[model samples]
Target: MYERLDKLRAEVERCKRKVEDDRQRLKAAEQKLQEAENTQILADVGALNLSPEQLADFLKLVANGQVGSAGTVSTVTAVNKETEVETKDDDDYDLEGLEDEEN
Candidate 1:
């Protein structure tokens, strides 16, 4: 009976090790999947930074219209340019509330 109990205990210990190994493998796979997703998202963002003509064609398709209105296209371009300028200006100055903190 003692020999049988020892065998059972050894088997249980082996099974626990196997379970821990499988869990670690699962965690690694999930991390790889997340990294792949992040890489794909970056690629998509890069694709969007195309030339004006290419961007206009893409927008037309996304809007489901054969032709986008000239005014709308101009407005979007202007807004993008303005935002770039604004962000550059923002970088020249420290953030308002953060700079004034006592700490």
Candidate 2:
């Protein structure tokens, strides 16, 4: 009977070790997933090509849920392509600089 008990204890120890190993693997997988998500967010924001100040201002606007001049809440949505947001009239922005950059 003691021999049987010893074998059972050994089996329990093996099972515990396996559970600990699985927990470690799960933690690693979660960390990897979080890092990948961060990278994807950075890539998405970087694709906007806005300057640091512009990006900060845009983020603040989004956080505040405000739209331009209307003082209304903004709606967040996903788009597969870049959409042109007409913030100002053509004369408001320096087109010559944009033209220079295009060349």
Candidate 3:
């Protein structure tokens, strides 16, 4: 009878410890979920507020030199300017060809 009583007491202690561990895990999980919810809310706000052009420019800026990568603002800006000039030159050529055809 005494041995059986000791076993019951040990089992109760084990159950208590397990319950405490489960409670701690539940609390940590809830905290993590709350953090994720906050992050998602911020992302939604940004998506709703920033226009496509603004978002594109921001991404370009980050990709260029802001993200700890090996890129410089000067280089990225120069490349973009170069691309614009090429596009403008192509437009000029098209206009010239149209003028020649008219003549």
Candidate 4:
């Protein structure tokens, strides 16, 4: 009888360990799936030509359930501002000085 009780206890322990391992595997699989989904989303967003700031706003809208029927006005405005700044920066460089230095 004691031997039978010991065997049953060992079986119960084994079952518990197996359940825990399966739970761990399930958790890992879920994490992997989430990472893959995020990667796909990033790729799709890149294809849309959104800047980093626009992308952040887009993600925020999606997360807040406010993405429906939103226009591209904000993103376009942000990109335009960035372009203006970049153009101004390029204009600030002294091209004549660069030519003189090379000569």
lDDT of each: 0.64, 0.72, 0.63, 0.68
Candidate 4 shows a clash count of: 0
Best by TM-score: 2
- Ordered by TM-score, highest first, the candidates read 2, 4, 1, 3
Per-residue C-alpha lDDT of model 2 across residues 1-103, encoded as one tens digit per residue:
5999999999999999999999999999999999999999999989988766666667776677654355433343322234433354335666897899999
Query: After superposition, which runs of candidate 2 have C-alpha atoms over 4 Å from their true positions?
Result: 67-103
Identify the candidate with maximal lDDT.
2
Better structure of 3 and 4 per lDDT: 4
Clashing pairs in 1: none
Better of 2 and 4 by lDDT: 2
Model 4 lDDT per residue over 21-49, tens place: 99999999999999999999888878978
The local lDDT score (0 to 100) that residue 28 gets in candidate 1 is 100
Encode model 1's per-residue lDDT on 5-66: one tens digit a residue. Answer: 99999999999999999999999999999999999977885776765655555556548653
Q: What is the TM-score of each candidate against the true structure?
A: 0.49, 0.61, 0.47, 0.54
Error of 3 at 33 (Å): 0.4
Task: Kindly indicate the candidate among 1 and 2 with the higher TM-score.
Answer: 2
Candidate 2's TM-score reads: 0.61
Candidate order by lDDT, decreasing, is: 2, 4, 1, 3
- Clash count list over all predictions: 0, 0, 0, 0
